[model samples]
Target chain A: MAKMNLLQAINSALDLAMAKHDNVYSFGEDTGGFGGVFRATSGLTEKYGKHRNFNTPLVEQGIIGFANGLASQGSYAVAEIQFGDYIFPAFDQIVNETAKFRYRSGNEFNVGGLTIRTPYGGGIAGGHYHSQSPEAYFAHTPGIKIVTPRNPYEAKGLLLSAIFEKNPVLFMEPKRLYRASTGEVPEEEYTIPLGKADVVKEGNDITVLGWGAQMEVTEKAVEKAEEDGVSCEVIDLRTISPWDVETVTQSVLKTGRLVISQEAPITGGFASEIAATVQDKCFLYLESPIARVSGIDVPYPLCHEKEYMADHLKIYEAIKRSMNY
Target chain B: MAKDKKHNTEIVTKPKWFDKDSVTIPMLQILKEDGSFHKDADMPAYDKELIVKIHDTMQFIRILDERMIAAQRQGRISFYLASRGEEAASVASAAALDFGDMIMGQYREQGALAYRGFTVEQFMNQLFSNEKDLGKGRQMPVHYGCADLNFMTISSPLGTQIPQATGYAFGQKMDKTENCTICYFGEGAASEGDFHAALNMASVYKVPVIFFCRNNGYAISTPAQGEQYGGDGIAPRGIGYGMKTIRIDGNDAFAVLKATQEARRLAVEENEPVLIEAMSYRMSGHSTSDDPTGYRTREEEAEWQAKDPLDRLQKWMMNEGWLDKDHVEEHHAEVKAKVLAALKESEKVPVPHIDELINDVYDEPTDMLKEQLDELKDHMRKYPDTYSKTSGRLD
Candidate 1:
């Protein structure tokens, strides 16, 4: 095991995936020479030839379309879309082409080898465009996997799993944790099964579920909740889509309360999806209605993003409200 | 068939293969590295008065970039993007335009804004995100927008401004205004679909607009050569769209001035859209947060430094006897002091008031926005030390 930052773990994961699979090819906008703006694919171009890992024009739709075709032809394609906010341009390509490629072809052809990586969420002072958490938009789309990692350790494992899995995956890396979150990650090859949840801490009173950067917020708020004589179980739902409902339902069965948190708007966020599913599964067991703490339903504010974000304090308030109820 | 912008659209007796080489656009280079021009090359405007102002502004910008980069390192500012090597590309081109014309910039066109009389104090106010800032500290540092100057607010998303520029120019056309619009972007932006859409629409609609492509060698880390595009740099695409296209030496102030002046004439008088590809290099990293040593070599940077746009313009001005060497030295010192003074003042100012958070959501804050704002205010009050205004801390 090696202590690595989130970005380093991600880079190590990409390096291992490319090294193990000869057919693996990584390409995207500004991803060559210098390893992209974030340097996630830094040494890939030099180690693998430019033909395998290279840069594409600054067109999101074109990059994903080309990646879908490449992966369909039996090549393991890993594509990067500079930022998650910029991924909207390629929405139709992802929703219509990448997601439906398998079922539409009736097992004749599929882009199951495709993995699109993009940095997402706020806390970097990225202002309007750079700070959006776009997981909710992709989460609603069927047939594609949406996976996010809580920290460095999870980042390395989940990314590898996404790449090797026989399905198209949208791997959203938390930019806020790219360097801030560090942990002991195995240097050797390993894969964490997708659609599974990791129980960070076990308790009896209440269960708090969050993913990606929101995991930190949940843990911090849980700490505060524990201080207030409340026992809280924390769970990181790594795979957002086709999420690990079994683990979450079991946690809620033991702890009769639930709080879901996310950086996106609460109205239609992935957190809402979790809340809806958990309520149905633990109807009689649940002592109180599940609460969701998320961003306001508006475009992310720049200067007042601190006021706009779904921080630990908000989560703490939700935990208190649920505990009282 | 008649010859248009490109070589004879002649009928071919037999089909033959044609490569990208057949339509190569030669780069227009007028000034040499040492401030002297090529044998027959001359400055475009030849206006001695405007020349002095251009050189002064360039020197001020060069100094401002140097100081602000150091300031960012010292944590005096959040971020900074320098217009270092390509100052002349923005400044000289702006020198050729009328202030009435609109400018839509994709970040890193501070030279254009500086040329349009955006003061150092104004720049620092925006950088520091003080109450004095016109944007109310809403945008990131270097994302300056001045409606008064007709310079549209910068959009961070690449190439989004390309199609917007076309629509803006179309509006100007409908009003029958003599003014046109100029949009600035890098060659990497040319790869976006918006670039193609903008060019096609502008040509078909016959709007007056100038599409300036700063063909800097790198887009953050991606180089322009075989990576960004396989064909020749952005100029060839303009030809494909049936628009007037020219490639110029962005480092040479003279070439930029000449090309822009001519493009402006075409745009304003003939209602023609012109595309100019200025070949230069990003002498610095993409931003203060970036480290260029990772992707680019020291030798490559040294080579571009030798072709520094500011040095070439200063040399030409000195050679023409329009500027004195001693005065240039004192002027540099003066600009350095001026920028440092502005930095000091901007840093001392407080950030925009807390109410600014929910004010601009609409003309009047909606009931929901007001409720959210009240909740945030209550949270901040509950954890005063947790969320500080002076220092943005979530801990």
Candidate 2:
């Protein structure tokens, strides 16, 4: 086992996946000699040569299209969109082509070995341009899978799974947590199955559900709640698309209350989906209405960074509000 | 990876740099514009039955377009895009390819799908957005996909399918299949970043894919002259990407077939990517929702009408003694009847079962999806009058 940052873990996963399969290649804007904006593909082109890893025109649609081409060839492709916010240009490729290939083709043709890597979320004050949680848009799209990680260990494992999965995987890396989030990860190859959640802390009063950078805030909130003599169980939902409803439901059933937290806007966010699910499946056990602590419905605001952002303090207040009844 | 500067210059050689024959492939014609054959020029000598069959399909598609456009105007449908002047580009190209070869199409290639045996009923079913529709009303009209026919569904975003075709063609090569994927887009779509990316990858990997561009003079209101940069059209960009390239009169069905045939030979046998630029015109509005009179003059439309692809094909049939006025009128009437009946039936059919909305996403719907489905069902049950049209058995 070794300790590494999310960026290094992601780079190692790419290197391992590419070195293991000659058909595996990578490319994006600055993904070649520059090793990507985040250096997730650092040293890949130098070692694998340009045929496998290279830089491309500053076009997101092209990068995705090229990746789709490689994937169709039975080649595993790990493509990067400079940032998550810019991926909308390639939305046609992801939502229209990549997502519907199997269903449209009557299961005759599908892209099982493709992964799109992008950095998402806004804790680093990336402003509106660089920061976004667009996973909800893709998660709603069928035939595509979504996975985001909070720590290096989950990042490496989930990425490997994404690389090997038999469908298009939108892997959103938390840009703010690339270095802020670190943990011990095994050098040996392993994969964390998608559609599962991890319970970081055990308690009975309420289930504090969060993902990506928001997991850190939820942990802080749990600590503060503990100091207030309010025990809370914190669950890190690593995969947001095929979210681990089983884990979340079981926790909700036991805790009898839920405080769903995410950095995305509260309206139409992942939190809303989870809240609706808790209301349906565990309503009988609920002591209070499910609460959501999230960014406002407004777009990731550039003018009031601290005021609109979700953090431990906001999470604590929401939890208190849910417990008031 | 090495940028071939000389090769690039050679591809961009202006038409002024070459004689007419050097630039334009001699169009394959069974008849002249006056409905008479040249005695000396070599002909492929297609059988009478096959010639009539091709004519029948073309006439049927033309009639279908007329009715569908009328339906859209009547507000029975949301939108419609017609092949209009470019039917030959689509129909003849489809006839040339093997059924197993994949097709990734833009909105205008319904002629290709119709020629490939996509039933008129299936077309109406999808267009009317009914239960029989393969997409189950999930998509807007013209976004057709048929798995059994190997035509990938049409996407709305311009040029997005270009790279996807490359990827799917690569998969065919990997499977050691003789099939190739044909992606059809307009010259307007060629300017998109995806087009450049798709061609670059297809050339680099030598994927068995054909990038078919219908360089139809305009992208809606923008004329090809100012909107795109290829002096000769989209063909040069294919060469720039190191792929095999060809240009042809898209209105000539024979030319489209010949170009696509040779392109298929390279893609299937040589694992090469080929780009075929079909010089054609968009005679109708970009969509039923558009008004082309705002941008183009009647003179421009009249000029293209003189080169009408349907008339040219009919002339060729007449010269071959394959079709006459009576036969043409009868075939036209028969196709109209078929389209009208299909449209009536399709509009009457119900939408897909409500449960179908949540099915096929996973082996089993996730608990969350199930929960959501339940909530929707409960909401419907509670408000039966509100959802009376859709609250039926789930498929």
Candidate 3:
């Protein structure tokens, strides 16, 4: 095992997958020799040879289309979208072609060997274009698995599992935690089962649920809530689609209250989905209504990043509200 | 942006408008109208088996289009798109490639699919959306795909496969397979952003992909002349991207075969992407939903009907003693009968079970999918009149 950041762990996972399978290819804008804008694919071109790992023209739709076509040939395509915000250009390909490739063809053709990796969430102060969490948009799309990781260990495990999952997967990496989040990761290959939620901390008063960078924020909020004589259970939802309902509902049933947070807008945010589902399952068991502490339904602001974000303070306030009710 | 090289050739003393019509790319027409070749034309070097296959696929497409249009009239299928006049543009080009090469065709390229060995039964099953259909009744009629045959599925969205072909060919190059890929789309589809994105990327990446643009006169209701582009067709776009480009008489089967053969050579031998613009006409309406009288003139349709690709190919083959009138008649009759039989047999087969509805959403249905399926089934059971009458599987 080695101590690595989220980016390193992701790179290690790509390296491991490419090493294990020659058919595994990784490419995108600036993802080749430059190792991506975030260097998430560093050293891959040299290690795997430029043929398999190379740069593509700066067209997001082209990248996804190319990846889909290659994956249709029974190859593993690991396509990187430069930024989650830029992935909109490829939205039709993902929602229509990639997701429906298997379903539309009745399993005769599939891009199941394809994994689309994009960095999501806001923290770098990169403004609108770079800082955005688009996971909610894809989570609503069926036929594709959506996975996000909170830390280094989870990043490596979930990413490996996505590549081998036999269904097109959208792996959203929390760019905000690329370097800020680090931990010991096993060098030996491993896979974390998708659609499973990991309970970071056990508590009985209230459940704080989030994924990716929000996991850390929720953990901090749980600490703040503890000071207020409230015990909160923290859950990291690794897979957004096919999310672990049993684990989350069980957690909500035990705590009798739930607060979900995300960087995306609250209106159609993934947090809203979780909050709605929790209320439906634990309706009679609830002491307070489900609270969604997420970003406002506006463009992500560059200057007011702290205020716009559902930071620990905002989540802490929401947890206190859930407890007060 | 295209004038930097002009400055190097000569200093501009006075401002002048560039004449777009100054350059005209000639269409490659080896086979002339009356069953003979142009004076200096060379016969395309193809095995007799391949020539026969291309001819047979064209005949198959002609029969399929005619009967399927009648089928649509009878309300047997929801929709159909006929490759009416652009047969050689699709089939001959398909005949030039190896079976390992990938074919990403638009909806009208059933000729190419047939050339790649898609059977009449498979075509009928897809059109009927029966249980035996490879698409599992998921897509509408005319959307066909066979991965085993290296033919990517037909998609409704125009030009989405253009960039996809570049990526697929890039994989072929990476695998060192000594193969190439062919992407087909119409002049109307060229207006899509994917067309520009695909051309620029294929050229920049130097992937072995042939972008075959069937410059059929209309894109549904939009004419290609002033609507699609102002410049000389899609051929110049290829030159602008610094790749080999060719324009061919799409109705001339020999020209299409020769152009594609040369393009494949450049692709597989040198890893160079090539673009071939085949000039043809959409003799029929875009799909069954359209009516040509709404947008085009009868005189215009008559002009292209005279250049019917099937008739031209038959004339050339007969003049060369490669075909007999009796054999050709027998072949057409056989194709019609076989297509009708397949249509009758396939439509009688039941549609896929209701369980298949949620099967390929993923390798295994998720909990959400399973729960949703249960809810749907209960809802269907409650309201059987609307579904069971047509599907006959609610119970």
- Indicate which candidate wins on lDDT: 1
- Model 1 CA lDDT for position B279: 91
Chain B: TM-scores of all predictions: 0.94, 0.89, 0.95
By summed lDDT, the worst window of 10 consecutive residues in model 1 chain A runs over A297-306
How close is each model in CA RMSD to the real structure?
2.9, 16.6, 19.9
Q: Write the per-residue lDDT of candidate 1 for residues A1-325, one digit (tens) a residue.
A: 9899999999999999999989999888768766878888888989988887888888898999999999999999999999998998899999999999989989899999999999999988887788999988888889899999999999999999999999999999999999899999999999899999999999999999999999998888999999999999999999998899999999999999999999987678888888888888889998888998888766775666777789999899989989898
lDDT of 1 by residue, B96-142 (tens): 99999999999889989999999999999988888799888877888
Q: Lowest lDDT 10-mer window, candidate 1 chain B?
A: B386-395
Clashing pairs in 1: none
lDDT ranking from best candidate downward: 1, 3, 2
Candidate 2 docking quality: incorrect, acceptable, medium or high: incorrect
Tens-digit lDDT track of model 2 for B1-395: 34559666434334545432344433345344454555774444356765565667778888988999999889888677888999988888887789999989998988888878899999998887777888666556778899999989876667889999999999999999889999999887787788988999999999999999998887665567643453556776776799888887788776677778888999999999999988889999887855777558899999999888889988877766777899989888888998999898888987666665555556667676666556556545654554555755532
Listed in order, each prediction's TM-score against the native is 0.95, 0.57, 0.57
Assess the local accuracy of residue B281 in candidate 3 as a C-alpha lDDT between 0 and 100. Answer: 93
| Candidate 2 residue-wise lDDT, A1-325, digit = tens | 8889999999888888887889888887657655766678878878999788876654678778878877877889888887898788899999998999889989887887889999998865454556788888998898888998888998999999999999889999999898887889888788999878999888999899998888888888889888988889999998888888999999999999899888887668888888888899998899998888776554453323444467777788778877787
Residue B15 in model 1: shift from native, Å?
A: 2.0
**Deviating ranges (above 4 Å) for candidate 3:** A1-325, B1-17, B389-395
- After TM-score superposition, the amount by which residue A45's alpha carbon in candidate 1 deviates from its true location, in angstroms, is 3.2
Candidate 2, residue B244: Cα displacement in angstroms equals: 1.9
Error of 1 at A232 (Å): 0.5
